[model samples]
Target: MIREQLEKADAIEARIQEKKQDGAGPEELEMLRIEKARMLRPLTHPNANERVYLARRIDRPHLKDFIPNLFTDFLEMKGDHLYGDDHAILGGIAFFHGRAVSVVGHCKGHSAEENLACCFGMPRPEGYRKALRIMEEAEKFQRPILTFIDTPGAYPGKDAEEHGQGEAIARNLAAMSRLTVPVISIVTGEGNSGGALAIGVANRILMLEYAVYSVLSPEGFASILWKDASRAPEAAGKMHLTAEDLVEAGVVDEIVPEPLGGAQEDPGRLYASLDKAIQEALCSFDGMMPEEIRAQRWEKFRRIGNGE
Candidate 1:
């Protein structure tokens, strides 16, 4: 059902783009807007598999697609130096607003083959290790770290467990929590489990409008409780994974609004908003000492479950 809606949405978007090229009249634009809105509205209330489907949508922008659009002179650094180079996590130095900083994000391929290579944005032990190494490097140079989280979770394969996936994630949490440099994590899409938090220990956490973050996916939760994945929609509503819900629960610091429908609809605009939010966050922490920043971060997380 959602697939059909997405296809129709894609067709409408293509038509709108074509009409614009041919100098679309206001009436044409308005008609196209209405058609697109219908598709977008239904998508806003996605079921569990639909949530996973949307996260893997071809139209959904990936970290690589947006980074180039957001920053200049991005030099990618590779390898964790132990297990191997994990393509799921890409890290490097980039100039954001003329300030050099380390940026890391989960990379998902736009196609099936690519997704396979990326493990569907599910990082293995090496990926978390690579991220920790990058964060350490960022701290060494006193550069702030910006992490774009969009993973489903850590890989559950036996091979991943053999390589110490849990330890890698734990190391990241411990290291990131103590690192003096400011850290900002943005949940641009699905942020599931320890995979997300391995790099999510940040001073500021922001999430896109349609993005969801949780320890487990809605379907997984539904299966455990209701024994039916079909009840995922109810699970999603209860999980409070949406940006607005996270913000209200104090789990996320801010809710970065996506373009009218969602980020997939306007990647450029989405990147711009993210760039601005990051810049503002960096500026606000300018004069604070490392100890002050660390204390603030700890305090923020500690207060999340306190009753109001």
Candidate 2:
């Protein structure tokens, strides 16, 4: 039914465009607008499955898309001091609202070739280490840190484990917790497992309205709990992984509203809202001492799942 509504809305929009090209007048255009809205009424309140589908859309805005829109003077940094660079995770120094800040994010590609290059946005041990390196630099400079999380999890391959993936993630968690500068994390898409949390310890955590952050994917949870991945929709309901759920549970500080039909459908509006939210969040910590910032983060994490 949702698909049908979307298709109908698309068809109406196509007609409206065609009419405009053929010199349709104001009355005709206004009628078409009303019809389009009526056709899309059912989709105004999407269900869990629809939200998950929107969140995981390959065409949805990624870190690369957000960086150019939200920040300026981006100077990309690469590599962990101990090993080679990992393409899956991108980090750098960027100016947000003319203030120098460090940015890091999981970068999933839009095409098959790009995905292969980015290892499907799965970071290896070196990737976590690289993020830690950039974050430490941010701390040293007293620049606020911004992280965009969108990964299923860290790389679970033998090579990653052999190279100390667990240790790298653990180190990031410890380091980020005590970083002297403010850290803000936004879940732009899938925020799964330790991979997400490794870069996620922050003073302010925000999630896109359609985005999800959880210990594991709904399909993975379903497979483990019921031995059937096909029951993912059911699992999503039970897990309370949606942005609204997280906000209500105090796991997320704010929920940035997405554009109509999700962020993929209208990126410009999404970027504008996200940029404003980030600026406000960063400003909220203004003039606070480093210890106060660190203590706030510490208390924030400790309160999660404790109903605080």
Candidate 3:
């Protein structure tokens, strides 16, 4: 059904472009616009697999793209004190609507070279450590921590394991749980496994409309459950991983709505909505004591999966 709608939308779009090139008049353009909208109307109710496809689009905006529009004076911080810098995780300080905050996110690249540079947005032990370091700094300065999660999972490479990848992720979970400063985490894309959770523990958790958060990718889950990775679509349906599903499950505090067709289709509008959501979330913590903030975060996570 989604493919049929896409095809129809694409065909209408092509005709619209062709007409414009041929100096079509306003009436013709208006008619084309109506046709296009009609073709895309059904897309407003995409299924879980369709949402997954949109969430994983390579053109979808990543951390680097969002930071410029949502924050100011972005100064990137690098390197874990214990090891070299991991490009997969970008961490730093920025001012969100004039409020100083620490930001950390998984960053996938647009090009092949850039993907290699960032390890396809798969963090290693060092990457998790770097985020932990920045989070600690935010706590010390009483700055709110904002994390954008968009990773397949932590790097499962041999080197990453040898370097204590599991331990690094575990440390982050513990530290984030206890941090006194308010923490907000948003899953902008693929939020898979402990890699996503390393920076995900927070006072409030938000997810983009089409974004997905799950214990494992659909493919992985399919392989484990049915011994067939090709049944990923089936797994995705059963996983209950969509933003709306997570919200109902109490796994996410809010859903930041994306523009029609998803974030990649209209990033400017998506960014604007995201900025507003972030501001509102931050305002909710105003005047709260440090211990109160910590307690709230702790209780929030404790209630997950409990139908609370």
Candidate 4:
């Protein structure tokens, strides 16, 4: 099934090329190419497996791509007071459109060494606590909170467990629930399990059109339920975790549009679109009081599954 998704669009492209070579003039060929481009199927409404693959593509935009492009004056904050620093979850204060905002997100590195250092964006207990610190700082300073979710899950290694990963994530959920400032979270890539939700309790939850967010990774779900990771494609189809599905279900407040294939195809456009969405989200809470902001956030989560 993964192979099916990765199969090149070679045949379709070849057929189009054949038409262009059929003695057409330059102007005619130009028009024909334009028509072909218009008909090229977009991953905007991609199937689950395709969406998952797109979300996992190495070239797709992640927190690393976003920070420099969307935010200014980003000052990287480090460490949880109780434990060591975690590169897996990057959090700091940044200026977004002239206003200060606390930004936190999972970091999947672009290189081998970076990946090892970032633990493939699977945050440990320290990472969650670091995120909590940044989030709380946002509330104290009365700045909006912006978080990006893009991890398979939290680090499940022995050290993480020994350091109380569950407790750290739980504390984040509880603290985020009561934060006095506006919180907006976007799923830029994979959003799996409590690792995603730890920083995802937001007044507005937005997901990229091609990103996949689920309770578990498809491979994990397949291995657990069917005892075979190879059945991941099947598991993906059944998950219903795509942006369109979540938006329709009211789990996501907005679906940020990406390029035809994925964010890697046009990351600049992705940045522009995401910037606008964040601006609008921040503006939405312009005149609300601290308690009002917290109450609105609570009500948003409460309405998620009740058809309100």
Best by TM-score: 3
Error (Å) of candidate 4 at residue 296 is 1.1
**Candidate 4: tens digits of C-alpha lDDT, residues 80-174:** 99878999999899999899999999998777787898999999999999999999888888999999999989999999999999999999999
lDDT of 2 by residue, 4-98 (tens): 77667778888999999999999999999889878766677777777778788787899999999999999999999787999999999989888
Instruction: Name the top lDDT candidate.
Output: 3
Question: What is the lDDT of every predicted structure here?
Answer: 0.85, 0.91, 0.92, 0.88
Q: After superposition, how far is residue 47 of candidate 4 from its true place, in Å?
A: 0.3
Q: Give candidate 1 regions above 4 Å deviation.
A: 1-6, 17-34, 37-56
Give the alpha carbon lDDT tens digit for every residue of 1-308 in model 1: 77788778889989988999999898989999898987778666665455555654656788888688877899998899986999999889999878999999898888899889888889999999999889999999999999999988899999999999999999998888898889999888899999999999999998877788888988899999999999987888788777767788888988776764457878878888888888888888999999998888888778887944
Ranking under lDDT, best-scoring first?
3, 2, 4, 1
TM-score leaderboard ranking: 3, 2, 1, 4
For residues 125-220, what per-residue lDDT tens digits would candidate 3 score against the true structure?
999999999999999999999999999999999999999999999999999999999999999999999999999999999899989999999999
- Give candidate 1's TM-score: 0.90
lDDT: the better of candidates 1 and 4: 4
Q: What is the lDDT of residue 114 in candidate 2?
A: 85
lDDT for model 4 comes to: 0.88
Q: Which ten residues in a row are the worst by lDDT in model 2?
A: 1-10
> What is the alpha-carbon lDDT for the whole of candidate 1?
0.85
